[model samples]
Target: MSKEPLYSLRMRAAQGGAHEEGGLHISGGERLGFRDEIEALVSGLLRKALQHSRGDADFINLTIEKVEPASCRVLSPLPVSTYEVADAEEGRRQAAVLLRELSVSEQAIRNALCLLGSVNNLRGAVLLDSRSGERLDTRGERGIRVSRMDWDRERYLYWQNQHPLFGSPRIAEAIALATKVAYAPGTVAELCWSDDPEYVTGYVGSRRSGYCRITRLKEQGDFSGGRVFFVEPGTFISEYIVHLERTPVWIG
Candidate 1:
């Protein structure tokens, strides 16, 4: 890839793709206020954001390359016997079987097979990473959810090590403050709890708190068994904590 500047607000309207290029109602006899209604909705959203943020505002930059709805159906629900297995290994085997039944991405399927990050945690529908979080998709009628993953070493390390969360009150407070400085509001983050145990542990957090509130516990351990994962409705990826799309911004 070549070095090029990524622009702000390069996004499309929620229903931008469905309309025609020469204005809406390609056929005649359409409602007059249709386009205006969309503009009003967008303006209202922006106003609310500005009001809530109180100054420091940034234009979210993204391009809608593709959008997919939770358009697949499962053949069957998980068997009740899966939760009753006694042995952990056996439990995982059964869960893996159930996971294979879900019509999600290969990554999500693989993670579920390995028992990563509450793979069983389904919200009636789930957003699986089919693309590198650069793609947006819908979860039933919920609308587009965004997904982005950060495997970059520099960002991930700094995210965890810089004034990292600890059990101490003062240290905890410091780490909390640092988290605010690190990421912006409405950002959902993946926080690790000390890389240990047999499996890699990860949990999700929102902008309201510096520390993750155990969206999925079992933090750090049994990772030798599999990777970590997070499940949710279509993700509304905020631009603040989002991964680097071009040159690294946080690092000098």
Candidate 2:
């Protein structure tokens, strides 16, 4: 028998209309801020249920009957006892294998799977041949780098206008600092904060990070990789680490 591929839960919002007070009225009139969250939750639950099932029938299919109140009705055509037995047996076997391979807890794996399923646009990860300097898609075909330079500039301008600290003086300083480095045409630079609110950093490289943080932006999946730019050590003298660690590493 062919090994079962890892399953992913897919969610569809119940199509319908809007209710009073500007509330969305899905099939069940369930109010949800984002559809992806519901998808993740459902996917996680199915994985959990399957883990407890004891059967050779290791699959659990779910259909969203209604969205307005977010209700799901599980569907299993096979006999419940047979399915449970097979699923539980397979689950234990898989759990043993997974435990040996993975260091993280089962919950973390489920959580990660849910997040992966919840993501609406994964922007397929590409591979760039470092030797030939060629950009290739997942299938090894030539790929194009999507340019968001203009959008980045616009966003920077908007942020500058909105923040008092990012006014003309700071903007000019930033521009001067940026000018020292030659940024490629498609390259995008952004000022972002680390997990800590107090730690702010500048990034100049590929579009992946920007694509993740900026909603309006879409990653072009540019595989045409290039050199990374960074200030040479001693370029700036400051108490903190003034120099960048390394050049751009090719992300395939």
Candidate 3:
């Protein structure tokens, strides 16, 4: 079977006249324009749709229809005077309910983190100590110390068991805590490790280890996973971390 088109938005402007006055025609076509904003919007919409699907076979095969600005205006005009005001209000109400449901679930948070990580251009993950402070190397030394709190090991373990199909246990655990501790609007959590040749330890015969970072956390849920976490070499996010061989040097 042919793969679905990576993009699903096609804008066909009228032959002549201002785009707004003449109005633009949008088609749910396979071709997408080269504009950065358009591409980002398409990707964000697709990601959100997929996350809502949650591995369902039907949604996996579903396609998005084109959305038009004019249609949205007609359907949800300002000043609360549009004919579709009631319908628009109902849509908003339904959306609010769904948001409440998803935001409270830990799985939704992890999925969001994953989607966010995918869109980030950065290659490395940030490291933070248990206290939510950034963990950075100083003077070429490791083992940074910070405040200690009763780490919620059980909660982390629970998240790991729940998402076996997704991220590594250790990474999942980290993400779970990060979601509750370091989370902020539009921030995403990333799992990173020291894989640089310069950072590799001769004893392990590898140059890298594992770490995690929390980035943008947002409310729109436009990303694929509910909460997204970027993964890097030597630092696998969620499920990937579980696959690595056990090492005692790195403590949670």
Candidate 4:
């Protein structure tokens, strides 16, 4: 296996490079060539760095030369930090990998990092785009949450009872606190987002029950179980602004 640091690997991936999933990965900037696209890559790298750096003072330099109005040249080696930042980040990454191998719950890892106190340095500004695999770099961003309504109460109950994230009673606490308005039994909360209205509704959310949930499950067999955390802010900024604006976050 390559001995390259995972951050280095991820940074390379962010910069229109290859990833483990496949090599056909093209960054949004590479495909669309927008300044925001490039900035998203930077933001994602920064977030990962912040997670690994554990709150060390750091800075990254990006040099871009315009090739044309639609595209630019990304000069190589946009080093985010030197010395302590890199070392500390490597330690954090090693810890995360080792802990995960031991079957530690993600919440446990996060809680341990929280006690370290530096991981909170992000200030709630990190936004990761799962579809495009990009991130927006900023302290303020529009955010969304998306989860398919396939997990019936039975699956939810099973997961809540058996899943590692649920091993801690704190998962219940977190879910309860995170859930804005608790749903009644047999009902579920849902949300969706889209960049274009034609592709999908700008935003859709509900707290009702119907057979449609089971129909969706029957339709998409692969996406059967998931607990999503966030959605791309740029694609759903309109909905995010109207209903789900974010506050500055230092602790979480």
Q: Give the whole-model CA lDDT for all candidates, comma-separated.
A: 0.28, 0.24, 0.25, 0.26
Candidate numbers, best lDDT first, in rank order:
1, 4, 3, 2
Question: Over the stretch 22-84, how does candidate 3's per-residue lDDT look in tens digits?
Answer: 321111112222233455645643453333211211221223333222211001000101111
Q: Across residues 1-252, which tens digit of lDDT does each residue of candidate 4 receive?
A: 112211101232221122232232111111112344456646754554344312222333233332222211111111111112133344344444433443434554454333232221122222333233233323321122211111222434655565453343323222322232112121122211111112111111122221011111111111111112223224454444222222211101
What TM-score would each prediction reach against the true structure? 0.23, 0.15, 0.19, 0.21
- Model 1, backbone clash pairs (residues 3+ apart or across chains), number: 12
Model 1, 1-252: lDDT tens digits are 112321212122211122223211111000001222435434543443333211222332223221111221111111111034444444444433433333234455454333334332111112234222222324322222122111123433544464354333222222332233224332232222211242222222223332332212243333222122223334454342232121122110
Model 1, position 135, has a per-residue lDDT of 23
Tell me the lDDT of model 3 at 41. Answer: 47
**lDDT (Cα, tens digit) per residue for candidate 2, span 1-252:** 112221222221211212222222111111111344456656554543333211111233344322221221111111101111133234333322332242323443343223222332221122222222222233221112111111123444654565544354322222322322223222222211111112122222222221111111112221121112222222221211111111111110
lDDT of 1 at 81: 13
Scanning candidate 1 in windows of ten residues, the lowest lDDT window is 24-33
Alpha carbon RMSD to native, model 1: 20.0
User: Cα-based RMSD of the predictions, in order?
Assistant: 20.0, 26.0, 22.5, 22.2
Candidate scoring better on TM-score of 2 and 3: 3
Task: Give each model's clash number.
Answer: 12, 19, 30, 0
Q: Model 1 scores what on Cα lDDT?
A: 0.28
Candidate 2: residue 195 lDDT (0-100) = 16
Best by TM-score: 1
